[model samples]
Target: MTPSTENRPQMSVEDFEELERHASETVRLEFINGRVQAKPVTDGNHDQIIAWLQRLCMQHRPELWLYGDRGMKVERYRRGRARPDGVLAPFGFPAGHGDWSEAAGVLMAVEVTSHDSDTHQRDRVEKPDAHAAAGIPVYLLIDRDDRSVVVFNQPEDGRYRHEEKLPFGAPVKLPEPVSITLDTEPLKEFAD
Candidate 1:
């Protein structure tokens, strides 16, 4: 038999949590509002940039913390959840629940874009707001298709006051005292 084309109804946060509690797969999943969605599959190009950025942040190992493709629920005024491609916290959170809201207060969150329409929207809109509302200082968006990195800072009124995009090899200076380089070429291979 061939695959069915029917679409399932979106799930709620509780349902999402229950699913998480019982899941066995490794694919990334995220929830926004009440809709749970799967993160876009990472191509080699995506991994290259993620590895590059992570290595760039290696100097902060002692007090600095890094979480790759982890779920973080931003607790601003409301409770919103997101699993950013990566996260940085100068100091990781104390022993608490295993979720993002519990593991740490984010200094920065990174989202690596892919080909799905839903994936792109969740990364661009819902996740950014969640990070900002949670008082995260920076949000970096890596758009694989365009080979660019968008840096967001100075959260005000549920959105970042500063938004800047840099091309490949452009210097990205984060508040965490590190100079990272973002290259666009590596991602071009995964655009397929």
Candidate 2:
């Protein structure tokens, strides 16, 4: 007999932990609002930008920690559990965990868009609401399609009150919770 729909387990932190328990080093997945998602394959452009940001954060803010592909706990029940491309957290705070880190003490989250349209939509549209709801102080999105970086801040009522976009050649200023001017010159756009 087929399992009843109600009996099937919805994606949650428990599932996330189970996946993490058996996942290979290369496996990358995200749990969002009872939906489990496989992260799209990242390209050179993605790696380049992440490396630049990592180095930049290290240089500017030696006291904090910048981690890649770290999972965060957003809500208590539904629509929680996000693993951003990069996360900047306070010193001594646990950045990696078996399940998910509580959103508290998280300074910022970053997403480097993939070429896939669905990935782009999720990064551009869906994640901001989730991150804002988590009360993360800042959210940075690097859009490969547009070769631009968008910063979201001032989370209130599950949405950001401010947004600023800058082209790849321009710098994006990270607002309070952390203070630093990101240099985007090293971030290269995908070749046409």
lDDT to native, each model: 0.67, 0.79
TM-score of 2: 0.84
C-alpha TM-score for every candidate: 0.77, 0.84
Residue 88 lDDT in model 1? 75
RMSD of each: 6.6, 3.9
Candidate 1 Cα misplacement greater than 4 A, ranges: 1-12, 60-62, 91-95, 176-192
Instruction: Write one digit per residue (lDDT tens) for candidate 2, span 75-109.
Output: 33335677789889877677355557777888999
Candidate 2 residue runs with Cα over 4 Å from true position: 1-12, 23-25, 75-79, 95-97, 189-192
Query: In model 1, how large is the Cα lDDT of residue 35?
Result: 60
- Residue 133 displacement in candidate 2 (angstroms): 0.8
